[model samples]
Target: AQSVTQPDARVTVSEGASLQLRCKYSYSGTPYLFWYVQYPRQGLQLLLKYYSGDPVVQGVNGFEAEFSKSNSSFHLRKASVHWSDSAVYFCVLSGNNYAQGLTFGLGTRVSVFP
Candidate 1:
């Protein structure tokens, strides 16, 4: 079984400041890590994914995440955030070939202040 834990329920960042969101996962085989952003009343958009190559994966809107197999963590980071970046971030793990279900974290609501 695959699972994810997002420690923070919410994060507030100032406009033009950097941000990092924490995520941890538990899986047996190779885990497919992903970061998804969801705006109010909108569906989740794929930020990035880590399957085979590179430990550091880049995503849209200057967002990036580092996959650490040792720590079992994949934390999202942004050099500078904008007010428009305010939204809910979710860490997800895709189940292996059988079900391929997505296990999502509770969520972290990011409030960007200007």
Candidate 2:
């Protein structure tokens, strides 16, 4: 089975500060990776996703993620954060097809301070 782990349960960053969220995934075969952010009262928004092409993919709102096959990691980064960026980020993993459904990490809560 595929699994994702988000080490940090919560992260606090100041406005305009660079942010990085760690995500480690375990899968027997090539997998699809995604990062979703959920605001206080909104649905999950797709931040970025990786399937096969580039190692690094750009996401919305200055967010980007890099997939490392050797390291089994897909880490998310932002050059600068804003107060409105505060939300819960989820690391999602899926098999080649969606037969097994998606595996999600516990989710990391981000708090951006002004």
Best by lDDT: 2
lDDT against the true structure, per candidate, is: 0.93, 0.96
| C-alpha RMSD in Å of predicted model 2 compared with the true structure | 0.9
Residue pairs with backbone overlap in model 2: none
Q: Estimate each model's TM-score.
A: 0.96, 0.96
How well does candidate 1 match the true structure in TM-score terms? 0.96
Q: Candidate 2 residues 1-114, lDDT tens each?
A: 789999999999999999999999999999899999999989999999999988999999999999999999999999999999999999999986577789999999999999
Q: Flag regions of model 2 displaced more than 4 Å.
A: none
Superposed model 1: Cα runs more than 4 Å off? none
RMSD of each: 1.0, 0.9
